[model samples]
Each structure stands twice: as C-alpha cells, then as structure tokens.
Target: MLQLEGLTRRFGANTAVDGVSLSVPAGQMVGVIGRSGAGKSTLLRMVNRLTEPSSGRVIHDGTEVTALRGQELRDWRTDCAMIFQQFNLVQRLDVLTNVLVGRLNHRRGFGATLGTLFKRFSAAERAMALSALARFDLAEQALQRADTLSGGQQQRVAIARALMQQPKLILADEPIASLDPRNAQVVMEALRDVNRRDGITVLCNLHHLETARHYCDRIVAMQKGRVMFDGTPAALTAARIRDIYGVSEDEFDTAPEMTAPALTPAREAALPA
Candidate 1:
C-alpha cells in the first residue's frame, strides 16, 4: 500500500502542492489529471522521491520513503520505477542493454559494470531483456541503438526498461503527451496490461480528459496546489473541470478544436498482442 498523509510542497512562499492526503491501495490504477501548474507533476514526483516534499510523509509497504538515505535510499528507489513524457534512455545505448540498466540496483558496482548501457548482456540477462522487450513488441529492435528507433518505439523501450526493474509501483508523468494517437494507445495498453495482469500499481499524469476517464480507476484533479476533485471518471463533470482548469463547457466549445476521444479497452488491447 502507498499512502500519503498531509503531503505538502512549497517553493518560496507559493505551495505547489497543498495539504493533500490520499491512499492508493495495492493494485489500484490512479490517474492525476489537471491543467498546467495544477501541481499534478509535483504530487507524482513525491511518490518516488524525485521531488522532495516540504512536509508530510510517504509510506510504501510500511517504510517511510523520505526518511531513507544511503544504501537504504538506493534500495527503496529500486522498488519503484518512473516513466516520463520524454523517453529518458541513453541515446547511444542499444535497446536491450538499456533495459538491463534497470537491474543496476540489484548488481554490485563491478558486476553491474559487466554490461554497460551499450554492451551485450549475459545469456540469462539477455533472455530476461528479451522477455521485457517482447511484451512491448520491441524484441526485434533489441540490438538497435536507442536513438535509431522511432518516438513510439523509444517509449516502448523505456517501458520495457521499467518492466525489467520489476517495480512494485509505476509513476508516469505525462507519459503519452509526446506520442501520436495510435502510439499512445500502444503504450497505454502495455501499462494497463501490467497493471491488470501483474497487479502492479500504476499512477499516471494525463492532460486529456478522455484518456484519464478511459484508463484510470480514479481521477485526481488539482487546481492552484489543491486537490479539487477525487473520484471516478463519471464525477469529473464539466463543473468540476471548470473548477480545476478554469474552463467551462461554453469556453471549451467556443475555443479552437480540442476534442479528444476516449481510448476504449478494446483499443488498448489492439497493440501487438
């Protein structure tokens, strides 16, 4: 279980994330959806210690996350994996080797050095890498350098790398923002598959309303450093959206075209299954 109690973060006098408290049960898939500067990213980063909170505690499996440091901190980080809108992989490294970097925490310095982010892997590790890649249909590109793959392919490779870590919790910040509609579904399907089949907890940041409504078990909407709404997709109505994003239905309808369709479960499964 992941729990946050009175979580708050501030920069100077402005609190980017206010007194937020929520608990995500194991295996739950939660979506953080809000407009720019709504503090969604700040809240998500607090989970994996990427952004230290100014106050409050984050508890994961009974351990206080922020209190960990040194080797203990290193160990805690291994339990969670983070994905980003920009695929943060070593550009010169081959896809397979890049995935193996996820195992760095498990291996000691020298043993971990055996396979740098660009080198080949051991027979056993190679098989493990292949399995992760196969799930995202990037096994054929295992030997290809990260820079050579398409944007969608790179994102899959990033997901494969995260899978290789065998994380208990996956935190993604605007993961699909950089993808096309088709590729976005592909990546989202892979995430939903792991969340459903393996029961790994998933927490993602989404800009599109339909995307959050379709894939998330719950949606958290924030505005001006506060959680404005927390409920099912059905509850994120026009009024709630306006409260958080300051955009009413009239404003949305009158503005330039910005309609995006919900990604159905069938479409999520339309990936390389």
Candidate 2:
C-alpha cells in the first residue's frame, strides 16, 4: 500500500500541501480533484520526490520513501513513475529512443548510463521499447522525431515511455488538461487501461469533475491544501461538488459540464483504441 502520513510542504510562509494523509491500496485508480491553488500538483510531486515535504513521511509498503538516499532514492523514483502535463519528450530524439530513456535506472555503472546518451541499447531492450510503443498504437511513428507528432500522439508516446519503467505506481498531474475533447477521452481511456490491465496504482490529479467520476474508482477532493471529501464517484453528488467549488446552486446549474463531451462516432473510430 501507499501511505502518506501528515505530508506537508511550505514555501516560506505559504503551506502548499497541509498535512494531507491518504492510504491507497494496491491497483486502485484514484483521482485527485480540486481547483487551482488547491495543492493537487504539489501533493503528487511530493510523492514522486520532485518536491521535498516540509514535515511528514511518505511510506510505501513499509519503506520510508522520504528517508531514502542516493541509489535508493533513484530506485524509488524509478518504481514510481511520473507523467507530466506537458509531454516531456526529448524533442530532437526519435520516438523509440525517448521511450528507452525509462530503462536508464536499470542500467548499472556510469559507462552504461553514458551509452544511453548515444542511443546504444541492447537489442532486447530495443524490442521491449518497440512493444511498448505498439501498445500505444504508435509503432509506425517509432522512427519519427517526437516533436513531429500531434499533441495527442506525443502524450501517448509519453505514456508508452512511462510503461517502459514498469513502475508500480503512476502519478499523472493534469495529464489531459491541454488536449482537445476527443484526445482527452483517448488519454483518459489509456490511463484507465493501464490501471486495469497492468494493475498499476494510479494517482492522477484532474481538473474535470466528470472526467474523474468517469475514470477513477475513487475520488479525493481537496480544498485549501486539505482533503475535504473522499469517496466513490456516486457519493460526490451535486451538492458536494457545489460545496467543494464554493458555488451557488444556480451557478452550479449554469456551469459547463466538467468533462469533455462524448466523441462523435467518426472521430472515435479515427483514434487508436
């Protein structure tokens, strides 16, 4: 299990994540939802050790993640992969090489690490990278430069790279926030597939209410750096949403749907499944 015990982060006088505690069982897909400045991004970053917590502990299956050092810390990061809002691909590199970067942690010694900079990977590793790309339906683009693909395709490439890590947990921060409606659905479905098929635990920070309700097994609502609600999607009713967002009933009614609309049949058929 993944446990966050009183995890808190402060910048000078501002406490970004305020003593947030959560216990996530294995294989659970959880959606962390909240408005801007609610600390959603910081929470995930802290778990991945991208940002250090002010005071608290991050424990995963009895290992005190916060206390890990050097190689241990690097290993923890490898075990817990992170997918960012912007597709963080090496724009100049080919798609296959970018995906192979995930295997860097598995390579021992400085020599092996240096070899990757020149795109020298074993045939078996190259095959594995190809397989991951195929899973995301980007096999044809394997030789293409990452910057040549569309936003949706680039994001899919990013997901394939994360798969190469063979991570136990995935922390996705606003993964689909920049995509168009159809692309957003495709990305969300891809994430759901990973959670179900590989049994990888997913902690995704989402901005859309309906998207979270649709893809997540459970939803965690945060307000002012603290969890205000934690339950299944059905339990996150209209009233609860209103309370979380601090909107009046009429305003809630007038607000736009919190997720991308359904894709048209033609558009759906054109995208990879």
Candidate 3:
C-alpha cells in the first residue's frame, strides 16, 4: 500500500535517512529497527510526510505522497494515521472524545458540531467509539478523563483513535518505549490484532531487536541514515545485527528482538480452503 523509493533526508551535513527504499503492502506489518541516530525514526517520519524529504518519493496507493502540501498533504495524512511514543491526547478530555477527534477530518457540519464540544455522540458513532476502547478493554474508562488513565491505557486510546480513522496505514514510532513489559505487550498485542483483522498496513520503528523479530513480517535495519539490511527474521543473525549496530555482544545484557508490527504470513495457493 506504501512505497518509498530512494528516500533521503538530511539535516545540515548529516543525512538522517539515505536513499532507503522499501514497500509495505496492504495488510502487512513491517518493523524498522536500528540504534540511536540510525535513521529509523527519520525514515518513518518521512513516509507520513511529517518530515519533508530532501529527495525521493513516498508513494501511497498510486499517488506520490512526497512534495505534497496543503489539502493534498492533509488528505494523505488522514488516510495514514501516525501513533507516537507519547500518547499526545488532551489530558483533560474524556477518553471517548479524545478518540472522536480522529473523525475531525471526515466529519462535517452537524455531526462535527455534536462532537467538537461537550455534545453527545450519536448512537452509531458512540457505539463505534466505545467499541474501539473495548478493543483494548478500556470501555469502562471511556467516560473518565484521560489523565486518570494509566500510560498503557492512554496509548491504547490513541490506537483506538487511529482505528476510528479506518486508516489504510499505521505508523507507530517507539510506541512501547514509555511502558513496562506487561503494558508494552498489551499495546503491541492490540496493534497485532488490528493489523490481522482489519488488514491495515503498519510500519513501526523500534529499538529492540527480539521484539521486531517476533512481530514483523519483514525487518528493515538502518544505520547512519541508510538501510543496511532488509530480510526475514531468520536472516537477521547475531553477526548481522552486530554489523548494523556496530556493537559487541558484551555491550548489552538482554538480546531481545524488537518485534514490532507485521510478521509476514506464509503464501497459500488460491485452491480450495
């Protein structure tokens, strides 16, 4: 659903993403893993047009998403929602309303009016919003203010908001960085469920390797603003990772793979199921 060709981004003399090209198909989840300043985040940001590319094109569906601005850019971003490391929700707003903000671009006139203020949502929209919260088992807390919810719950709410958009692609940048192991698992599992059932394309940038290995259909490794490796989890051996990170085995304790979004599904022939 998304394609990046020869994508490059530079800040002064330092290139953050260097000529990286990759494809994320519809319903696929791909993980981006790299060390600090390795350009993983830069690559993801460029895909959504949040960071303008110095060169190259980001193609979504068929349109060239790069170099688009104003209404064109806004419309492109609407179809491809971005979830961040920070929840970025309005702390004082109710969880339900926070998610309703996803519809801001699509909703019009009267229906938009009902949600902009303290106005109550319609039966259908409310149900859909509540269903999103329940996907992360936070429906009970929908009426509660966002500040009262835990960090994990808040991130889940953010994901629900993205889901409410019915986006074609989801970009998550270190989404689990702020959570504990248990909570991180919760959020990641929620993402997996969304990708599986809804067929939404996902590209997540993560620091951990083991985590990516487990969750991603394909792993794209970056180093010094360029793609160093792109392959299956099995192909990313210890030696390969060392080459990408330039770190020795003794540099860290745990060797957890940064399993993020989609693990590739095995191809099946279209015969009889």
Candidate 4:
C-alpha cells in the first residue's frame, strides 16, 4: 500500500500541498482531478520523491520513502517511475534508446558501466525494450528519433519507457493534457492496460473529468490543496464537481484553458535522481 500521512509542501509562505493524507491500495489505478494550481501535480511528484514534502511522511508498504537516500534513493526511483506532461525524453536519441534509459538503475558492475558509457545495450535488454515498445504499438518507430513522433505517439513512448522500468508504481502527471481527444484516449487505454495486465499501481493526474471517470477505478478530487472528494467514478456526480471546483458542471467538463500546474523552484530542482 502507498500511504501519505499529513503530506504538505510549502513554497515560501504559500503552501502548495496542504496536509494531504490518502492511502492507495496495491495495483489500483487512481485519477487525481482538480483545477489549475490545485496542487494535484505536486502531490504526485511528492509520492515519486521528485519533490520532497514540507512536513509529513510517505510510506510504501512498510518502507518510509521520505527517509531514503543515496543508492537507496536511486533504487526507490527505479521502483517508482514518473511520466511527465511534456514526455521528458532525449529528443535527439532514438525511441528505443530512450526506453532503455529505464534500465539504467538496474545495470551493475563494470560491464554495465562500460555498456552505458559506450551507449551499448545487451541483446536481451534490447529485446526487452522492443517488447515494451511493441506493447504500445511503437515498435515500428523504435529506430526513429523521439522528437519526430506526434504528441500522442511521444506520450505513448513515454508510457513504454515507464514499462521498461518494471516499476512497482507509476506516477503520471497530466500525461494526456497536451494530446487531442483521440490520442488522449489511446494513452489512457495504454495506462489502463499496464495497470490491469502488469498489476502495477498507477496514480495519474488528469485535467478532464469525463476522461478520469472513464478510465480510473477511483477518482480523487482536490481543491485548494486538499482532497475534496474520493470515491468511485460512478459516485462523482455533477453537483459534486460544482461543489468541489466552485464551477458549474459544463464549465468543469469543457475547461478550455486548463494547464498542468507549474512547480515551485524548491520543488522543481527535486526531479528524480
């Protein structure tokens, strides 16, 4: 299980995440929804240890995540993969190479070091990466530059890269925000597949209510840095969205200017090591 106990993040005088607490069961697919600046992304980043909390504890199973450091920290990152809105990839690198980056932490001893230094991958690792790409229907584009793919394809590649990590959990922060509706559906389906087939725990930050309702096993609504609602998608009624977001149902459904909230400078530098 993943537990957040009184998790909070402060940016100077402003608190980005305010004493948030929640528990996520293993293999559950959760969608976090909130308006812009609602601290939704910050919460996910904190769970992945990409952003440290101000005052609280994050525990996975029995391990205290906030206490991890050094090689422990690196290993923790491998165990929890993070997917970003921008599809953070080495744009100049081949698609397969980017996916192989997930295996960096698993490499050991001199041969692994030398292979990485020389940009060489073992045949078995190459095959594994190819299989991950194939899962997302991107094997044909494996040799293409990551920058050459469309927005949706790039996001799918990012998902494949996360799968390559063989992680116990996935933290996706607004993964579909930049894609069109069709592409967003594809990405959501891909994530759903990862959750169901591999049983990896998935915590995704989403902008659209219907998208969340359609793909998530549970929906967690946040407002002003606190969890406003937590329940099955079927329980999230139109009136509840209005109450949580202080907007009418239609306004929440057709949000035109919503964007992934930015991180504070203190949190920005806390990216996964």
The candidate scoring highest on TM-score is: 4
Best by lDDT: 4
Write model 2 residue lDDT over 131-245, tens digit each, in one string: 9889888999999999999888888888888988999999999999889989989999999999999999999998788899999999998877899999999999888887777
Residue runs of model 2 more than 4 Å from their true location after superposition: 248-273
In the range 66-134, model 1's lDDT, one tens digit per residue, is 799888877777788889889899998788888988877877677566655435456877799899999
Computed on alpha carbons, the lDDT of every model, listed in order, comes to 0.81, 0.88, 0.81, 0.89
Q: Per-residue lDDT for 238 in model 4? A: 89
Residue 60's lDDT within candidate 3 is 84
lDDT of 3 by residue, 1-273 (tens): 788999987665567678888887799888888766677777888888767788899998889998678877877788899999989999998999999888776766665766667646667778899999987899899999999998999999999999888799999998998899889889888998989989899998887777888888888887777888899988988887777666753342244433233212131111111
Model 1 backbone overlap count: 0
Query: Over all chains combined, what TM-score does candidate 4 have?
Result: 0.93
Candidate 1 local accuracy as lDDT? 0.81
Candidate 3 wrong stretches, greater than 4 Å = 109-115, 118-120, 248-273
**Winner by TM-score between candidate 4 and candidate 1:** 4
Better of 2 and 3 by lDDT: 2
